[model samples]
Target chain A: MKRITHFYSLTPEWQHSFAKEMGGELIDNKIIVIPEDIGHGYSYFTQVTPGISVLYVDFVLDTPIKITRQKSDNELYIFHFDMSEHVNLIRINKIDYRIGTHEDLGLAIIDNKMKSTFKPAVGDRTLAVRLLVDKKLLDEFIKTHPSEEHGNRKISVPKKSLYYYDHIDSHSMLLIRSIKDRSVFDSSFESYLKGISLRLLGNFLDRYEHSQAVKDEITDVEIESVTKTQTYLLDNLYNPFPSVPFLSKMAGMSPSKYKMIFKKQFHNTPKNLFIEEKMILANRLLQSGDYKTLTEVIYELNYSKLSYFCSKYYELFHRKPADDLVKKKYNQKCITKSTLQ
Target chain B: MKIIEHSFGPDLDWLPHYAEQLGGKIDGNFIIAPDNGIRYILPCGEGISAFYVDVTYNSDFHKIQKNRDTDFIGLYYNLTDGEATLTARDFMYNVSRWHYNLSVIDGLINTDYVVKSGSRTYGLAIFIKKSIIESYAKKENIVINQIEEITNPEKNTIIRFDRMSYDSYYILEELHKQKVGGPIFDFNLAGTVHLLISNYLRKLSTNKIILQTVNQTDLNNIILIQKYLIEHAEETFPSIKQMADMANMSESKFKILFRKITGSTPNVFFMENKLIKAKELLEEKQYSISQISDKFHFTNNSYFTSKFKEYYGLSPKIFIKHL
Candidate 1:
């Protein structure tokens, strides 16, 4: 049998076989499974807290892999935070959902079989944190202490359900970052991990309970179109910008309907989103020091007038492009001087 | 500014002078009216500390700095209509009401905290020493990299905001309502503080990703609508138009967002919440069937009984009798 390094390759009955194949040992009910000849990645499952456990997989993939796992009997709440730049496909309920880099925080319930294709932008690393919680414990707790204030109205974990948020809030981001921090592996490693795990679960549930109350009213087709519109806008940030009507046509919706759905999905109007994307790209280019001057950045962003570009840059970053350039140069000079010294 | 520090156990001398020292005049235990505001720090156990503060002033007058001797993680619970801003290094945060924030502070860093005036504010601050947290983490076998970073002497402070769970909120409310002081008071205070700490730790662990998918304005509106529903749970259910008007959202958008943020439609959510409250009242066994139904504004006892049975699969009388 071929070695199963990636998660998608493992079938339901392959767990024991794979464990034996990899010479993996179980510690505290957790099997550390390392695939044969896979150098940079390993996956492990550990029961950190009572009735709660985590399946932490970290890998730098060399080749793209389509992984599918059959949903088990027990209900599982999975929080997927992808810290990579590449977009991955997660198909659930016959809808292919796109999980973008750091931009999408996925809260999904896997009661039925599901498949996820992990395709990275060649050579780039894929670092994702997936937290799984037992549904019994969570549901029991919610049943006893129902709070309309906390938005704990009803939690129905269907066989296949997927929820995605565009951005993780600052607090959750910090906590997640803290989990990824490698410095704190002391004697209390297990306790610390459990503590962080439980806290992360609580935070996710709190937000999920509230946000899930507001169901994603858009259909799968609408979501796909909106997602496509978003991808098109991002891809053409530097190209001649398309009008709302043109993009709406691409989405197969009337211009007005398209704008409404797009805004609902992305939280920004098409025009504003386009400008934001351009400004982000421009900022990256400026910070990279690839563009020698502000004029170069303006041309790179396809802006005709330097003043208009500068104003837009100022509006976005609260500083002019020339000022940022000067600061960047000065900072670089200081770093160089320090290195030389 | 005056600084009053009292450690837990027998002596609480600093408690008496606490209000006065911080430019405040006290009416007995509570700080009545102050020239500005008052702060009282009461350290508890090994590495656990508590601070009680109430402020009402027009400007940012008091700047309370943590003593530079110990590094601690601060749990700040703000119960105020006004804003409490904490500025440390590059970040400035507005501490929202009824929400608890966990902050790891480097004693060496120049972190400034000020409560803006024009609103009366009351809150509790619990600070657990990094060593205590480390010790607890060790005992529990928890691996928190943030704790390691926070323990480092050179790193800046870290803060995360989270809402108070219903259980914790009730406990805090109970603690606040307890006016009597004695052995019972001490026991209650200690137990409540421990519960709050554990609650904070649990919250910290389960918060994986903080996604602000809903913008602040919408969130605030949703919160307002929820508060209205909860506060008037006994009253007649408000119409969707009334709720939308209150939230300043269009009726259709409001309905969609309300259901989106809350898993049930407006009427269902309201009815379910009302029934839940009715169950709680029934469990108390204080009120009669007619009184309970009247209180909840149910048209008749039969209607209330039907709804209660639908929710819990048991009649109110049966549930009460079993209890």
Candidate 2:
């Protein structure tokens, strides 16, 4: 009763709450309550009632979810859904209950069976004993027969397939806001989908941070700085061009402050992009077969001073550019090295 | 280069407080000036244009240009990204026919600005067509502030490359993690989107452009691999093992992923690959009974001939000239 904006209800209780009884009454029973409301993690559970039958549920609450956007933050919303994966017993902890919503309780199952059109068997028309929930568009799905598990005809959907159907009303935009534990939404629907997906990855190999304040008040100045910083990286691919000092000056920022903005947008230090940019260019050249020798490629990419470039190249290509160029060409482009298959 | 022109609300004021308060609704031209930068010239007086406000530099009346009284010809806009600002330089390209050349560098306002919203942050200057703006001027003046911006359903969720966030890096690493175990691994079926993320991450990590990440390329590689592996898995077959090694992937990982990507694992995939090879060879069934065995690289001519018989259920020679 503490103004629970999110609560994960058990399958049995959730199912029974909306279920009808013999006397045409909703089964309003005392629901099973759990006090162990943990804030965030993933929890799965399944439970059964003696005559009521078995019920199972799995939910993750307050857990970071990933969503990609092509653009930066032009809008925001929350995502909730009804999904299926069989469970034998109900055993939820604190995770799934945190951000749970009412629609999350039953939408998936309801959507799967509910219909909007009218149709009944002509030959086996029996005096229907009772009416289910709402009589509007939803009631159209009340089965002509109860015990039938799946629909009369099975529509085989493949793996990873998405099937979305809806009536005009009861529809609201659902936003996928966070990933793992980061907030990457900064731009538009067309520019930063992958960026957002990567930004949400908290348990990342490439550690990154998100600042709430900067996002709350994203000024034109900040946008300009980020843009300038990125452009420098693209242009200065093969230079000892700008250290943090030079880079910061280019973007009109203090070095320390520039690091924070860089961390948010690129998920690394300002110098990191420069570093990767070199390796990326070198890799492209190797794949393109531009270098006549390993020494030539190294000198051309200006890795003369830093041994880091070669080591990084080795890491990226899984081999040196000299030895890998022929293989890279054959692999990158499917021009046959041998006519014999 | 398709200039999509549409009218927003009638009360649209592009200049905001910058304009002299023209009592009722003031209509300013919804303008998005084409920038000087573009890969190539594809006509339309403008390049990729967007009508939006630069909320960062926007105060009131900062972005106002000509009044209804002026006969302005053409508009030129400049975007100073360093300040997160957009300023316009309006003039007539052909001033003789079009009377005015008023140059105003007004700061944009009121419209919600987009920051960090692309592959990288870029400053875009949008331009509206002169002819289009002139079409409406005869009846009433038009002022374009910023066209409505779209709200995102997926916000703050991005996957970027940075070596700082340990967790972000970890996700990429896990995706790169190789399973050396034998074929048959658990495949967690998330959804289409999840698989796409996983696939993109893997390709980026491998940095190997073996195949483009299109539906057909991914499908063909799976099919080809599956076909090549099938027939070679005989006796103490090393074909499946060799293929996985060729890919520099764990046998189990390769098998499970291949099955998921296609519908067959290393062994079954090998069988399919082999079956297809056998079909092609069967069509060319000629030469010698013994020579044909050597053609498919079978250990023994009889064995090759026998396997061919098992596969096609017909002797090699008869299956050959029959065509």
Candidate 3:
């Protein structure tokens, strides 16, 4: 294992130091392509706007590499997105944290004062996007756009070093995916990236404000329970929604406490999440075209009564199952017709 | 008809001007529409501004005249059902629905258009400083023909009349579906506008699209054919020979002119509008799939399903999931 240490910053000096440590050469004054001996891919850095910069690193390591950033006095917030093909691992102030599996992707925000180390799971592609933003700028934005939780109150950042990590909401995730999927059109790529960066910053500030308003400290044990409950719900989506009491008992917590913690952690009610997932699954099944009739789909998912299933599906997806079936068949027919022609 | 004159540019200060004219109040970056719809004005950057409006006028017709003091390049996207006539000086064009709807014009002079009411008017306008675009073009070593023409500054020369490609359409859809509020909403709107501008620039970079000014009479004929098709969307599509005869032109000439103006064949245009109309009926929830197919004069339900799926990427039955 090779370990590299550097003082924290998103400037040329810091980028050069990291590049040198990784035995790579800096190119175009903005990118450092990884040396073939160590990995494939490159790290790109850009100043989106004043007070906000983005550093995107993507590579697969032939050997394990750990990058450590020494604690600094700069008041900055690092919004890190780990989009690796597998689980992404990191340590903040000697506390270990693991995340970024496809099903469990999230954003991790760390205060600049805390020493942090990134230990990506190797032999697989490691993709990460980090936005370095000035704390003062973030505070200014929060003052103008107060979260619902902290309505009309003058919110301030506490003196304690902040380290918060949570699942990226679907909306934010969609924005991130759009950014990733964009092809570089040279003329306006910078402006395009800057626009996406602002969007991400805006979303983060809102989330941070809401997080600051919550006074209760969530424990590791509680997080574990909530995570386990989420996995259980996702796995049993085909089955009817397990009652709150049933889930709470499994999590070894009171029913009301469980519900509160679930909402706080996932930002969704248990029943709503279950229904949403069930509908999503139903959509996939209906699109698969293996099932000829909507009734077969309803029965396959343990649903009874075509009308009841249609209403629930409509409530969640706003479209009927029958339409999806016809859509599937129609698409197949078009494919055949085109080929024949 | 009501006349509403307005100007939009780099700053959002023009929002107040619009609010005062519309009898609405300005709320931060939004114009709280008095009753009909939503309006967002976003200042994207130093020399870029974007505006989005989705409203149905209480009046039957409104003629909006845009008069700008400064020279700016305006990228306008008209997404409403075809109910608009864009008049840039003497060159007049009817707004095509979705397809071939992007119009880029130099806003050096006064230009006005008429928008009919009773249906929603959804559109986005992006204003960019002409100097900024010139500097960008020079720095990037790319020359857009229309940009150079701006050196002499033709009064109302349209830079390009093109279709919104699939990518642009997807971005527009995302913009329409945006649900965030507050500063995030502002950022999302601005970011999306930049994306649209970026897409427009990318298309221009290829230098394939050029200034296309059609004859007024020819444009009028195309508009007439389009309106006729839209009106009879429920009926069977007229043959190209019949349409050509109706337009008083040869079949090949009529086909070429229609494809050039609309970016689609006549049959495709008719069927697309028909499917869209069928989608609206589906939203009404008054008819079953069979009933809609029968009403549309399709041979059978499966054929209707295939056509709907081909055009919408989802069968009418399943596409309702979004409604």
In terms of lDDT, the best-performing candidate is 3
Q: Find the 10 residues in a row with the least total lDDT in model 2 chain B.
A: B182-191
Point out where model 3 deviates above 4 Å.
A7-29, A137-162, A179-185, A201-341, B13-15, B32-36, B60-71, B146-158, B179-181, B206-323
Compared with the true structure, the alpha-carbon lDDT of candidate 1 equals 0.59
Ranking by lDDT: 3, 1, 2
Clashing pairs in 3: A318-B321, A319-B320, A319-B321, A323-B317, A323-B318, A324-B318
Which tens-of-lDDT digit does each residue in A251-330 have in candidate 2?
A: 77688877777787678676666767777787777676655566666787777743666678777657765556533232
Sort all candidates by TM-score, best to worst. Answer: 3, 1, 2
lDDT by residue (A113-150, candidate 1, tens digit) is: 34443333335555555666556766675675466643
DockQ of each: 0.01, 0.01, 0.14
Number of the top DockQ candidate: 3
TM-score of each model, in listed order: 0.37, 0.20, 0.60
**What DockQ does candidate 3 score?**
0.14
| DockQ, Cα level, model 1 | 0.01
TM-score of chain B of each: 0.63, 0.27, 0.66
Error of 2 at A154 (Å): 49
Interface RMSD (Å) of candidate 2: 26.6
